[model samples]
Target: MKKMSTDNKLISLLRQSYGTSNPQEAATFLSSAIGRVLKMEKEARRAHITEALKGVDLRRDAGGGMNSKPKTVYKDTKATQEKLAKLEATLQEMKAKYHALLNDGPQTAEENTRLKNRIAELQKSIENQKSQHFQELALLRQHSSNVANASELAALQQQLEDFQELSTQLSDECEQHKTRLKTLEATLEDKTAQVARLKKVMAEVAAGDEANETNVHQLELELANAQEALAVARKQNEEYNDKLLATLDSHLAANHEIDELNAKLVAALDFGQVFADEADHWKNAHDQKYADYEELQRRAEQTQTEVQSKYVDEHQRYKAASRKIDSIIEEKDGLHRQITHVRSLLKFEEQKSSDLTRQLSAARLEMTSMTDDLAQEKRVSELYAKNIRELHDQLALLKNRPVLPDWLFSGSMASGICFGLLFSFSADVAPAQRVLLGVCSGAVAFTVARIITKKNHQ
Candidate 1:
């Protein structure tokens, strides 16, 4: 009965807080509010943990372990803290912007849900990174101390291992950043697509009403400003990427330096070993000087023969190399000559091409002249055809008339008589003979006219 009373009181409190008469709605609001409070508490705890991590310095112990000391490792926790702070600030800014977006206008339920999921994932990733960083710091602290009696080589080995591990961790972090960058790019693309969709919808809406045109235009300007802001953000992300790459490069260079140091140390160790071996050899030789005399003499003779053989071999090799060099020089000269010949050929081909081009131009001009001449001939042919048609019409009219005209006969007779009289006077002929000649000439003229007219008709 007491539990029931307490539940009733809690329900009454939830109803009053939500100002809802419906019990179900009140319960839902209370549940969601409690969830939000729990989430805020988690975030606070994470913040506290990160703050605690900031004070932990991962420094290597500098105690002596050998004659040559290993390089000291100093990793500043402040840089990590700064990065975390920046991330948190960015997250907060995103949350603020998201809240502003929610207040500005209605959004799709799917979009809100997706954004919530993404925020949750980001929080989870940050938590995982924090845990991983804590583990790495613990590992560093664990290995910071060196054994006092350890050899220099052993210390160097340990240092090399530590550097390798650190490089691996850096590589992992770089990969994580790359993945995060890709995710951001994908999110940016989605946002740009969403903006485009919104613009399209606004345009459709604006088309429906002239009264809202001004509002639509204002919205367009706001969208444009948003796009500009997005571009600025993208540019900043690119700058951050460049900075990360530079850091990776620096780490790689440090690793390279470490490798060089290791090589030098190895070389020094080898040289010391060789010096010790040589010293031991000389010391033994001094203790057995007389006993080694014959052995030394035989060894000297053997060395002299070997030297002579080596000298002969070297001379032969020198001769062979000299011959090879001579052959190579001759080959090089031949190649040079070939190259010069090819160049001359290329020049000749170029000249030939120019000549061909000029010929083509001339051919084109000749073709144009030929076409003009053809057109003139066509005009002249047309004129000739017209003249022939006129002549045919005249011939047809002539065929319809008599072969000789009555007027023509009289005119001819008179002209003949006059010509005959002139001939008679000149030759002192009689009037009778002149008249006869005139008559005959007139008759012959009439006959000739008749025949010519008949042929024209035919």
Candidate 2:
């Protein structure tokens, strides 16, 4: 009875499973139930056989006693009959169920045909789904690749911006350098002008020195001639004085001898008056020459003083300008060193930027490759799903069972559901396609749900 109850429970389970009208589900359920029943039956049979063997052994040990022989034989026969009857009944029940299931042959055939059609349609749909999934994967990969490319592009653009900024700064620096150079050149020109002026001054000083030398020489010659003239005048005056003295002595002797000498004395007084006037004129001329020589010497001293002052001023200015020039040269040298340092920094920056660009490029390439692999995997998964569906259909046909009903097939619904799942699961999709799929699926589900609700309300 317990075995019968268990069989009934299994049958009930089979019926319930079949009622769901899903062939694969039914197959799976039925196969499991069948396996369980077979196992249980085998275990029961094994136990029963073992008991029968033990009974035979006991009968043989009783050594042909009538009671032992009849009891053991009857028990063994009865157990065999019961087991056979139970097996036969179970077989008959299974046959009746199989017959009942086959009674709707035309309907089952039609359902099967429809199921095959639906399966084919579903397979095609699934294939399309797979293709769409592949495309979506490809689109996702493309988006990922594009994102990587955009990142690289942004980096490159940033580098370019940096380069441009550096270039602008360099240009500004160059302008400043040019201005500085011009200023230095102007300073050099001023220095040159100053040098030229100093040279002119020195030339004037030289000319003045030459003039002073000539004046000194001329003055020396004039002094010598004046001294000679003074000596000759003194000599002439001495000789004349000597001759007058002699004439006075002779006149004195003649006066003593002759008292009539008064007329001759008056004539000697007139000649002495003419000689005194000439001597006074010569003394005034000699004093005027001495004053002229003193005036020339004073003028020469003033000229020398003026020349000395000019030389001192010029020397100071030249020294100051030279210092300034040295400072400018030092500044220029410092600027050159700064430029060299800046150039080295720029070179290092350029190398770093180049390395960054290369790394970005490599990363983008890797992303593209990964995306392609993902797309391929999606395609393979789709193919596998299609194959499973085909095999399922073939298996249903082989089992001589009705395929699932159209209402339970769920091809279109499953496709839409899968699309939704895929859309939700993955974030990589083309904008246009994603939007279109979302809208279409949403509309379909909404329409179906609304129709069902309206029908239910009615």
Candidate 3:
């Protein structure tokens, strides 16, 4: 009866929480919850009774420095939480790097402006050099025309000697510049190799991160499953606690009923004892009052038969009551065994819940680690992207920059120079004609070299 009242109160609370106008649905939910709650409580009581009876050993692990299983689980759970915190910290660092990568756009824009300025400066310098060379050529041509005065002729000769010396020095520098170009080419090759290695590493890291992401997702699903199981176990445990209370109430009520029955049986036995005593007194009184011996003896026999029959019925009734009590005791014993079995099952479930919770924590740690790794991979990939962009920009700038050192065009220019030298040395040709041919060939070679360079760049 008390259990029924408790169920009613619980149902009322649930109905309030449900807050539904449809009472029918609420009643249905109430019925289900009551049944579930009752079942859980009953199971839990049985389990506790089993533990009290020492029917099942809860500790499967006896190789123990630990006092109990729960303490060990607590220690492990605490350790896992600490590791999870560390993983979270690492993940935060990775997030910071990702943000940094996102902020690099402004820096790339600044680099573009710098490259543009450098290009403009190179163009201005090339124009200035061209104008200065043309002015010097004009002055040298005028000087070559007038050399009638000895002093002026001597000065002109000295100027020509200085120009020749400058040409020889420039050739020697060009030879040295060619050797430097070879070394620079080797260094550029090494840099390209390094860049290729970096690209390979980035690709591998990205692939590994992708794999870890998939693994973490699987772990998340498993963790969710474990959590659901744990919730179910907790609900069952609550139901068991409720059932234990209800069973204890029922047992107490049964004990009270047995006590009442025992009291009534004792009262009935006392009344039977008093009635037997009265019958004995009546026999003694009848004997003394009887005058005729034969008549008195017959009356006594008849009373004796009646008294014996009544006593036999009372004995049978007492035996039946005692048997019924014995049956109740046996039933109670059966209940105790069932309770013990339930306790074993409860312990098993508790162990399962603990293991599942531990696995869930481990999965969470793995997921956090995977997330951090993925972030790091993303940051690295972004860095690679930036480096690639800068490299492309540098390559474009190098291609467009003004050509340097006349020897850069030596292939075509050498052909022209050779033709000019051959024409200057020819016995059949006029000096002016040879000079004009040489100049035209030189112009042709320069044009051809420029065209080839442009085509190569394109």
Q: Candidates' TM-scores?
A: 0.23, 0.25, 0.26
The Cα RMSD of model 2 versus the native structure comes to 33.4
Clashing pairs in 1: none
Q: For each candidate, what is the lDDT? A: 0.53, 0.53, 0.54
lDDT of 2 by residue, 1-458 (tens): 98777666666545544443344554666676666557666777465334333422221222333232121111457889999999999999988976775563333557646754665575567556755665677567666655755565555555555555555555555555555555555555555555555555556655655665565565555555555555555565555555455555554554453333333334445677765555455445544544654554465455445554545555554555555546555654655565555555555555555555555555555545555554555555556556555555644444453222233223444556556646843875433344345446644754575466446645
Best lDDT among the predictions, by candidate number: 3
- Enumerate clash totals for all models, in the order shown: 0, 0, 8
Sorted by TM-score (best first), the order is 3, 2, 1
Report model 2's TM-score to 2 decimal places.
0.25
Error of 3 at 103 (Å): 99
The ten-residue window of minimal lDDT in model 2 covers 65-74
Model 1 per-residue lDDT tens digits across residues 217-296: 55555555555655555565556556545655654565565455556556656788765555555445543543444455
Ranking by lDDT: 3, 2, 1
How far residue 12's Cα lies from its native spot in candidate 1, in Å, is: 99
Write candidate 3's Cα lDDT for 189-290 as tens digits: 555555555555556655655655565565556555555655555565556545555655655665565556556556656888765555555545444443
